[model samples]
Target: MPDTPAAPRFRSGAGRICLDFMRTLRLRGMDGATEELDTPEALAAWVAQLGPYPGGTKIPAPAEGVLGEARAVREAVYALLTAARSPAGPAGCPPKERGLLNRAAAAAPPVPVLDAAGSVTWTAGDPVGAVLADIARDALSLATSPALDRVRACSGPHCAAWFLDTSRPGNRRWCSMETCGNQAKKHAWRTRHATATAI
Candidate 1:
């Protein structure tokens, strides 16, 4: 049997579901970007892995066009958030994309369910649509909330990831300290040593 490809790791540092959804765009550092959610099965798997889903709950197969819709929604959310991060706030989501999100938001809204521990957790009746709705809602909230001011794109060259600056001084510039931050530190250290040796 062929080995199954590993699922893309979803980064949650963006501090918002919508931003995390946008991170699904693979190879953000490359010219030829890959689509992480490339198929219906991938979409189903993503939905199953979302934080709200109960463990072992069998998600229904996505209907035809659902994958396309998901990609469309993802792009729309990306564009809107990118614009919002700019000095000038986003003009707003394009009409067609907004309509797509609104429709999804209206269909199969997530409901809070009580888990075995009696804590409230959300679940959607139609997993795909519900996930989209939750993402749409989160995007809208981020666009309108004060948290918009805290959103920052990674400073690493070739990296296009965004993250929320939740640090005390609010000066964070990388998607992660372990990845881009470390790379930058190493590069600076090498440059300093090279200059010292030449001198």
Candidate 2:
């Protein structure tokens, strides 16, 4: 029997919590858009993978209302950032999006706990909401700072993701070298090979 393939997991390393969260709606504003956070359990799973929670910690799935709120927060982050990256800058951030971010940011975030074992773990009364708050705060900071210039939309033809250009030269592209980057490289190679063979 063929070996079972690993599951497709959430994308990360976007350089900001909010940016990473924004990708939960993969291929946003593009064809084949996929909603990865379609369920409350999926939101909890995202917190486990992306939040400051410790490994093996069980995050309870939020209620339907909270799930809706989290999705709203994610969209707000995306819209706010898109506007901030524009020529109009942060001023382009709409009042509705700004207010949503403000409310989300006001919520309590995960509390850090230091143990005698020299390990730190995070806890929150509402883990999902806490993670949302963290994302909101991060979005607010990124949208207004000079670092906004470093945030870039992926160059992948079909990818609607964004990532921070942390390279020294600020020429980084693609959301991940393992995914979109690899696909782009393969495509380029195939194009070159096809041209060479034709000639």
Candidate 3:
């Protein structure tokens, strides 16, 4: 049997749902970008992975324009969060984007429920709306709360990913030490070794 394609790897280091949502725009550094949520099936799968939806809750397949709308909302949320972290105080969210978020936030909101193991999980009538609402709420909170100071864009070359610096020193620089951090370390080692060789 032919091997199945592996699912896209999402960056979870953002430490916030809204930031992670922004990460769906893959390879921001490259000319051609890969969109993780490119299809209705992909969207459905992504929603299912974000689980604790009621056992049999059926997520309606996204219609023609839904994916575009979702992407637009993600971009808006990204803009707002990045602006909050800017040296200058938070930039105002574009009116159209803000209005889009407001509509999503007003949709069927997610309900938190405790499972048998006593862990809190979420469920909603419309999975897409619920996820969007969650993202909107998170963005609003991060923008207004002191936590906004914790947001940091990764310093890796050609990397545009954002993450929350939860360290006591607040000095994080990479999205993930296992990935971009390691790459940076290797590059530095090569540079130092080359300099010594020249000497």
| Candidate No. with top lDDT | 2
Ranking by TM-score: 2, 1, 3
RMSD of 2: 2.4
Candidate 1 lDDT, tens digit per residue, 11-65? 5667778877887886565797778787788778777776467766777769769
Instruction: Give the top-scoring candidate (TM-score).
Output: 2
Tens-digit lDDT string for candidate 3 (1-199): 9999775445565788888888888776576677988887666666665534754456777875878878887888876776666664455766777777777777777789888998886777677878878888788788878988888888888677888889899999998998899999999999999999999
Pairs clashing in candidate 1? Answer: none
The global C-alpha lDDT for each of the candidates, from Candidate 1 onward, is 0.78, 0.91, 0.77
lDDT of 2 by residue, 1-199 (tens): 9999656478889989898999999888888899999999999889988899987789998898988999999999988998898887877888998999999999999999999999988999999989999999999999998899999999999899888899999999888889899999999999999999999
Model 2: lDDT equals: 0.91
- After TM-score superposition, the amount by which residue 53's alpha carbon in candidate 3 deviates from its true location, in angstroms, is 4.3
* Per-model TM-score versus the true fold: 0.84, 0.94, 0.84
Error of 1 at 121 (Å): 3.9
